[model samples]
Target: MSFSLSTTVVSPEGEQLYTFEYAALVTQTSIALVQVYVELGVIEAIGSMLHPREIARIAQIQRLRQDLGLNLAGAAMVLDMAAEIAQLRAQLKAHQSRPQNELF
Candidate 1:
């Protein structure tokens, strides 16, 4: 049950799962808001369990909405774009790290 910035609780099977209520608590938001996010497909849940990453995503969404004055859909789209950019950057880095073939 560590609340460290980089720590998340995991089960014996190495799966990290938390209830919707716990996710709301962790994000300092309301359970109704959590439910709205789920209903809006902003954050997904498996049954009543949510991955820690989803909780973090919820916090990010809230920050974007409150701090940046973005709407929910805009926030979600921004997050999706950010994730895509990160993935593309990682791929570009990996390609740059590979050895070039001799052309001459």
Candidate 2:
């Protein structure tokens, strides 16, 4: 992934707001997971993968909710993360199969 800063604006209180844009060659599931997080209000914006502990926590919450016979958003998040992990694993396998010299 690569990112570029566009500009920075300073507030009267001396706070800085930096504007930027980023581009990345990413998998489909990565995008899906981001969308899920956004819908759940877990993040302000769609971005990269959540930490492993975060994933585990979400999964645990989902289980607990199910045990209580309650519906929640955590299960959806877990599915999204699982899909992303599978997609990434596939990409890794594909990359590994290519000749070493072909990688750069």
Mind giving the per-residue lDDT tens digits that candidate 1 earns over 18-93? 8777887779998899999999999988776788889999999989999999999999999999999999999988
Candidate 1, superposed: residue stretches over 4 Å from native:
1-13, 102-104
- For model 1, what is the alpha-carbon lDDT of residue 12? 66
Q: Which prediction has the highest TM-score against the true structure?
A: 1
lDDT of each: 0.85, 0.49
Among residues 3 or more apart in sequence or in different chains, the pairs in candidate 1 whose N, CA or C atoms overlap within 3 Å are none
Stretches > 4 Å off in candidate 2: 1-71
lDDT of 2 by residue, 26-77 (tens): 2212445445544776444313333333444444544546676545565556
* Residue 47 lDDT (model 2): 33
